[model samples]
Target: MATDDGMRLAYYIVLLVVIGGAMLFELSGRGGKALRQLVLWVVIFAGAAFAAELWMNDGLGGRQTITSEGRIEIPASRDGHFHLTARLNGTDVRFIVDTGASSIALGPADARRIGIDPDDLAYVGSAMTANGQVQTAPVTIDELAIGDIVDRNVRAWVIDGELDGSLLGMSYLRTFARVSFENDLLVLER
Candidate 1:
């Protein structure tokens, strides 16, 4: 583990010990009832902690269901965004589904990870973003796949600005015959 992670774990352990000790001291006179209450509280705290950890790790919202009928269902995250994982040139890439975006736009890091050199690309194209206008470089993904669905020679752009993550925009979403929101899930049918 990294130094930061070790320190965080130690801090939580120390906090739990201190809290447990305080609870024990407060319940000393109550005997068996106090012990039961303490155990109950511990179980509740542990359950809450486990749930928080799952939410932080994207365990709850990162699940994508691909049906045999070529339909992909994505759950909306707690943050109210739909995220999907697709293979870009055979490399796994995570993207936030942005219907407002005209095309698939990759951040510098993602572009580099999928074997594209951002430094070598000429940023001749430009895009107007929420922040401002930013330079972009047009690139074609050799293969983009999500489950059994695959598209080749897909048009995309590399954004020359700070982007938290790559975007799965209308350019790619248009490939699906139907894109709809059912209940809380985003459904895309090819």
Candidate 2:
């Protein structure tokens, strides 16, 4: 094993030994109670670790599903926001569906990923965001696709300020024949 892996294993082993020794000392006379407490602690730690793993893997966002009839269903994330992954210029980009946003907004990182250079764009437009007015650069997305649906020459803006992630706003949602939220799920029909 690599040095780092070996060291980590050693650290975990040491931790287990220390914790086990302490538990044994504290529960020297109570056999049944000690076993029950140990089981409870194990369950608690296991549950916490599982939750951390799920959060790190974005499992909490739930999964986006596409139907055979070309309908897209997005489940609300734990934070109560609908998020979906779409192809922007053939590059996978994660976006949060924001009804308040007037147009599709791309963060600088996502803009660059889709072959748009933020440095080359002219920040002539301004947007009123929650953080106040921010400079924006208008651009045309060569292609934007969600599941089997695709659109070309899509108008979007690159926000010249801090953005957690890209925003999929009304600009694209308007194309859907039907957009509705039911039971914490956002459904988009073409």
Per-candidate TM-scores read: 0.73, 0.73
Q: Model 2, 79-138: lDDT tens per residue? A: 889989899998989999999999999999999999999999999999998889999999
- Quantify all predictions' global Cα lDDT against the true fold: 0.86, 0.85
- Which pairs, if any, clash in model 1? none
* Candidate 2, position 90, lDDT: 85
lDDT of 1 at 100: 96
Q: What lDDT score goes with residue 174 in model 1?
A: 91
Task: Name the regions of candidate 2 deviating beyond 4 angstroms.
Answer: 1-49, 57-61
In model 1, state the lDDT of residue 94: 88
RMSD of 1: 7.1
